[model samples]
Target: MVETTSHTATVRLPGSKSVTARALFLAALADGTSRLITPLEAADTVAFADGLSTLGFPVDRGGDVWSITGNPTGPPAETAVVWCHDSGTAARFLPALVSLGAGDFVIDASEQMRARPMGPLLRALGSLGVRVHAANGDRIPLRIDADGVEGGVVQVDAGASSQYLSALCLMAPGTRNGLTIEVLDEVSVPYVELTLAMMREFGVTATRQGSRITIGPGTYQARDYVIEPDASTASYFFAAAAVTGNTVTVLGLGRNSRQGDLRFATEVLSAMGCEVTVDDDRTTVTGPTHLRSPGEVVMRDISDTMMTLAAIAPYADGPVRITDVGNCRIKESDRIDAMASALDACGITVHTGADWLEITPGRPHSALVQTRADHRIAMSMSVLGIRTAGIRFDDADCVGKTFPGFHQELAGLQEAWQRG
Candidate 1:
């Protein structure tokens, strides 16, 4: 394990993983060929792109960009076994997409992915006239017998996963019946907006009358799309600024980034006593003399930053309360529990509830953090270890899920800081 050192640095992050993955999926379903510039090449995005190819989408990657010639109507074949690996997006989003083809398809994933929940999305698919075969009650390693979607009204409990709503919306335009999606509870409103924004980019419009959305019969137009730098990944570096009392600038994510996770800086960082600056193509965070507690924050939209704030909690002057992030439980791991447990293992005072966590300011000791193969856990914990000591983890490579070469970038940042 390498000790992290933070100094004033400009960190150029990879493209937004969420946008890249969403674009890849949309590109594969577009009317013509679409090109993606500076797309993220991480494990999850690769899994998404590869999964699309496996399902007969034929993604072409070359030179400075990648292109996909899509079948706007849907996948060309009827029967396919989609290999989702451990990508939650692919595992959840692909089934609805495959429903567009009138065939029997099996959706399977890696061991870890299989452990994640899929029941809600499965039930939502079932309501859309897709025949599902999940012996274990609509989980992964499931099969679908779909004769195309007869979309009408689908009720989704977005509390578990917003991808359920996004998947249905993306496939809605191609469905003969279109779709009227009603959200019982939405975990992340921004994620759904990102989906809607991309759908518009593809020349389709989804009308949302409050909690219900109507989408249909519109064709997806193929166009060149550029992905933004990851706001989630930028959260850690922004935390580095707050913790190390240095300036950290994340390049490429601007003031108007659609990635809702960017609010980590605007909300969490500023509330934590850091000065944040947003420009046209970059955001910079400058640390205060000492970090302060944000008091209480409900991360319904930017819950991915909970770990980042958790990392900074121990240094704050008061307890930090994070609520309304219960949806994080069904992510790569139960992030709330993972974070609480890791903080406990690190000798920090952590109070965990069903959906809320209160972390008290205290000095943390050397601890072996168990990451549970969660990328956010590893990266967020690493941010905490920047100025602290003996923060070790065996599964640091888990960051490859979203930010491949993450440690390399950390090392480079530290090296440059040291040289300065």
Candidate 2:
């Protein structure tokens, strides 16, 4: 086994991809130039910037900050090509921005993203009067002809993906008729709230009343914003500590941060027997030498960490039950199935249910992991590989979607432990 020696180290992460993507969209749609400080410079966020640039938003990066010029009047290109690649944020959010533009836009993605769900968001855009043309049902390589979004009441079941609702909400302020989004069923509700909170910072108002969100026929005002550290990415390092019996400290993810994934440290890791201490400056995770099961975990809101916890499941002393994470099936990959398959490859017994997974611990054998072109899968599986040998990745580069230096971070972990 390639178990890491117990060590103490504080790691500083790049800015939040979720916040950076939304900020880029809002800044691109605003009237004034907005300065994004310490934004995430990763593949997915870069795809967002590239797509926005294609839509005529000039993004300039110098040092850690990004200066993006907003194009309030829409893209100059009448017919635009927007590439979302493997980013769910770009796939879902960018289409709504196109609907607010006076142009014909075509969006495409990698094979991984093509398999994810987007029909609900597309149909919602169609309800706003944008002509959507999807090839072979509602997949990417689709065309959108938009004079502009004339929003009224748009309904979407965000249960499959909260990005579906965020896609509609981001461009609602720019719509002529405003918008009232009816959430048929919601998952990752905190992410939607984060989007709204960022929207308010950009000078747009989104009032959430129960499942319906009312937004005005308004516009975003560009402002200087600082992106918080990535909480989703933080889960991996936290998992590193948990699996290796080390102390991992993450800097910049303060307690007041908006990224909902931070709760994974508190709810999941701590519940799994790690000692978690959060403060305004940083969060520290001290792993127990012997891992324990936290019983059944319901990961409805903090489902992004589903795979992270899955990576740690093999190390558990007893069976660990995970529930309320059915929506994970539609993420970058079928995470439930991916976890099942990966765990099975490592000799762990995994029982899959419609909305739950029960992972029974065993002496894990090293196995080649398949990432399915999913960032979370790559990262999570990497964590599992740390404490076990023969942990090879089929597509290790997929972590570039969020954490470009993830492998380097793993290397740094080794250095810290060695130094200790």
Candidate 3:
């Protein structure tokens, strides 16, 4: 980790992982050729594209711009297995995509991914007339025997992850009868909105009426799409500024960003006493001399940045309490538990509940951070490493899951901060 006290920095991050994954899926299902400009090239997204290729979707992943020839009918393969690695999006979203084909598709995943929840999505698929056979029940390594999805009314419990509803929504256009989804419980609702927005960009329309959302029978029209910078990843640099009382500007994400996580800059950072300025294409955060706590905040929609706040909380003027993020338990790791453990290891006073984390302000000491093979954990801890000495990560390499060059960029920032 790059340890430093200076915090003035400017960062240009990669495309949004959520948007890139959704674009890959949508591009694969479009009726013609689709071009993804500056798409994210990382482990999880590569797995998604590779899985698409395995299912017979022609994906040309050359350079930053990827071209995909969409097949609206479905995957060309009659039988195939998609190894999703640790990508929850692929593990959850691809099964629904493959269900639109007349084949037996097995969606497999890494050991960690297999432990995450999939029941809600599987049950919804089953309700839509797709046969799901899972030996372990509700988990991956499951086979979906599909003639085609004759999508109709189905109910889904999206309390664990909104990807369940987003997955079904992404594939709804290709179904014969369209889809009427009744969401029983929803968390991270903003992600589903992103999916719907992208669907509309590709020329498909959907409507939401309270808990019910409807998508009529149609197919996506292939078009060139440009992905925005990742807001969740930018939170780390924003936190760096807050921790060290300096300024940081992240380019390519501002008022026009479709990602809900952008609230971390416009809302969370501002609430923490950082002067946040959001222009059309960039956001600048000037940290307060003494960071203030944004007490008792609910992170259900922007939970991905929960660790970013937790990392900088020890420097706050008061205790920082984040709540309503119970869904973090089923992420790449038990994110809530992981944050609690990492914060505790840093010799900071902390408390955790089923859906909340509270960190009391105290002088933090150096400790080895355990990343639990999660990208978010690694990146968030790196933010703390900026102000604390001896803050090392056990598995820093896991950051390759999303931002492959995170360490290098952070190191560059450290050097730039020191030079000035």
For all candidates in order, the CA lDDT equals 0.85, 0.87, 0.90
Name the weakest run of 10 consecutive residues (lDDT summed) in model 3. 1-10
TM-score of 2: 0.96
Taking all chains together, the TM-score of candidate 1 against the true structure is: 0.96
Q: Give me the runs in candidate 2 sitting further than 4 Å from their true place.
A: 1-6
Cα RMSD to the true fold for all candidates? 2.4, 1.8, 2.0
Predicted structure 3: lDDT = 0.90
Error of 2 at 47 (Å): 0.9
Task: Put down candidate 1 lDDT per residue, 106-213, tens digits, no spaces.
Answer: 889998888887777888888777888885786789888877777798898888778888888888988887899888988778988999989998898788989999
**Candidate 2 clashing pairs, residues 3+ apart or interchain:** none
Query: What is candidate 2's lDDT per residue for 234-282, written digit by digit as tens?
Result: 9999999998889989999978888889988988888877899999989
**TM-score for each candidate, following the candidate numbering:** 0.96, 0.96, 0.97
- Candidate 3 wrong stretches, greater than 4 Å: 1-8
lDDT of 3 by residue, 1-420 (tens): 122343567888998999999999999989999999988999999999999999999999989899999999889899998999999989989999999999788999899998886899988998888999975788889898989988889999999899999999999999999999999999988899999999999999999999999999898999999988988899998888877777788989989888999898889989988889999989998888778889888999999999999998888889999999999998989898999899899888889999998999887788988899999999998988877888899998999999999999988877777777
Which pairs clash inside model 3?
none
Better of 2 and 3 by TM-score: 3
Whole-model alpha-carbon lDDT for candidate 2: 0.87
TM-score top scorer: 3
